[model samples]
Target: MPEKNVPTSPPTCPTDLSLIDSTYPVGVPLTATYRLGFAFKTINLRLPVILTKIIDQLSRDKNEIGESCGQEARDDVKIVVGALAKFKNEMVTNKPIYKTGCKIWDSYLEHIAQLYFEGVVEDVKWYFAPWLHVECYFYKRIHDAFQLSNHLKSFDPFRKQKEDGFECSKKSSAQLAEYVLSSDSSDAVLQTLLEVGLWGNRCDLSLSSGEEVSQLGNLVDQLQGLRNFVLCDESANFWKILKDAKTANPDNPLTVGYVLDNAGFELFTDFCLADKLMDRVDRIDFYVKTTPWFISDALKTDFDWLIERMCSGDCSDFPVLVKLAERWKGYVLSKRWTVVESEFWTYPHAYFEMQDADPELYSTLTKHTHLIFKGDLNYRKLIGDVSWKPDTPFKDALRGFCPAPLLSLRTLKADCIAGLRAGLAEEIESKSQDWLVSGEYGIMQHAQ
Candidate 1:
């Protein structure tokens, strides 16, 4: 369980995120230079709080962790805590971000220089570097602190938070499972599951800085109520694509790839979608992070944990969970559902760069008929974390990344976005100026 007393509330800041001015060119990477922007607030406020929580979680779980991993792990816990404290200080103090001399990261810096900067850049600071790179680095360094340890090298500081998040959402998960299990393979059911998976992006722990969050009530029942909030509804297009693919390849095996996001209710929603998709698609491939990332990204362990709990735990109140879990287990055992991990996912590179950065993973992705990318971070990478015009076409914003026909089901949580119709962004801003950074609104954007 997570340390209940650890305070992870975000510090109060300006609610009107649009008030922050951006001086970068239209296609430049999002940096924290804009004082009032979400990137800046994330660096100066949210990330440090997240780091503090990691430190606090370590301290609280000291005894249990030690017992599990042995005495060396206990001593290493103090060391990791101290390292995290120093890391928090570095971020809070606006210290320069240094390159890890590792080949992969250093090459990425070179890639950034060749692509974004004109090559003479040197110092990368917490408050001024590219938001995506620095943010990923922050997590990488946290893992580094443990990777250097003896007994705690495999320890996931974020495990408890991920577990607690799932526990909190079991009610909604069971409800969603039952809804899917009882429903027919209708377009309505598919659309409902897609929206549920989209809204599930809102439960991200990184967005909340590790605060407990849950999916509550009847999620399927709430779909219509939240329909208007979908800024871009490409579901009709999505359905057409699915229909075309199924009709054209009736004999050939059809596969779908899910570049997964948060691990709890969001992951549960992902499973619901995958379960629904299995009726049409032959195989499902789930790509998870190799390490604990951005607080709640699913690791292979988290993927297994949820399934194991559902399969073995007392589900008297929600037997459908066990039924669904057993079915999913059979799918896994039969290789109908495969869990995949790649170092490419943890890298800071954008999706467009995948061909050059990790060709094998890119080749693997091409075999899938369509890729469903979930959450804000994946959306950011899809567009290279650049600030495109609000009305920019999603494909144009992709900058030529077409691994497969892809759909990004993302709740707006950052300043960067694309594929809004003319004047749509402004009209939404008139209602809620903070809509860009707020998770209230969403987009089901498609790109081919």
Candidate 2:
């Protein structure tokens, strides 16, 4: 287990917690505008109930594990669930959410209130619903605790800033020449490269003038060399497998599935991958959450207010353009990919159990489909988002789960690193303490 970096300061309460507690709960039923306030209250109350179910399951399974497993899992869940129950009770009783550093707590609570008033309660709730609200809600509470105690010095789980200086430096002129001369399939490669580049550019953390267009141009140039290696005799073997699958089962369409993440650029990347797979396969099915609170760009569902705002020229800045491109990409991809929205992924059940419960969903997912899970949150879900050691093997971490030919493409945005090569963790530790959580490095893993 990872050691907790606790602070040695007394706890304090935020001044605005009272304001937030009173106004938020009352506003739920009294608001005359949108029903968002009521939605937020409903979701918040439901969180504790969901968490109670998870806690019950953990207790039942504790006796079946080893001494260490039983002790650790039970202890961790007890502390976490206990903290959640205390927090919820405090809220119900109109107590301050934070004991110290009240200003920051107030600011965050105000932000939550504004988001609710602005009709983003559904997005906020869905984002927190995973793992019965244990992960995100715990993080939010931790943030509040640290801020109140003035313990920012000790809390360093997330990197202070995104690592943004990486550039592809090498060139393969000879390979590029051979690829151009030998293949009639260059167009597919070029198009795939364009889509990935555009998606990356649009979603980039840093904003720029014509960033998407500029990145698209540079990506086309950079990928030409990479494409050559991927298309070589030895590498083309994989393509042959895909081709054979397509040829032998013409009646059974090849399905490409995307387990989605955040909206905008992230969704664009899913589209790029979907388009590439669609070029080779017969069909594509994109899965999304079915609840109003669970909808995201990944589902290609409409956010009517946001679309209307954009259309009314409310968002005209370069950064806004990048966001607009993200929504537009989803709109464009929905035309080709068969979109399936479900509540299973949002539930607390294990993947195989979810599959067992919904055989049709699993059958559709497992048959002829190459599943692509995107971003940090999805990666967490894929691995159960536990506190595995940094050097744990990917296969070991994923022991209980298997869902088609899967590839997890993610920039490291949180704790819980695994599948490291020998000495890779040591090398990273020697150079930077924050490397694992920095979102600097990425992974391309295929667990079949």
Ten-residue stretch with the least lDDT total in model 2: 161-170
What is the C-alpha lDDT profile of model 1 across 1-448, one tens digit per residue? 1112233456533343333455446777888777757788788678888887788888998898879889789989988888888877777766666667778998777666655456634656666678999899999999988976788888888898888888888888888898989998888888889998999888888877888877778888888878889999887777787789889878878888999999988899899988988887889999999988999999999999989989875665779999999999999999999999998889998888889989999999988888899999999999989989989999998889988999999999899999999899889999998899778899999988
- List runs of model 1 lying over 4 Å from the truth: 1-25, 113-121
lDDT of candidate model 2 versus the reference: 0.42
Alpha-carbon lDDT, every model:
0.84, 0.42
TM-score of 1: 0.93
Per residue, candidate 2 scores C-alpha lDDT tens digits across 1-448 of 0011212222122223312322122112121112233222322443334334334543554444225344444345445445546665653333322422344334434444454535333333331222223333333563343333222213221111110111110112112223333334444663453334222422322111011211223333554444321201122333445667778987766766766653433443444444445557666666764432221223334222223333344334323333443544455456544567775655433353445546777777777457666655566656655555655776666755665766665655445546766677677668766554444455555566
Clashes of each: 0, 7
Question: Could you say which candidate leads in TM-score?
Answer: 1
State, as a TM-score between 0 and 1, how close model 2 is to the true structure: 0.48
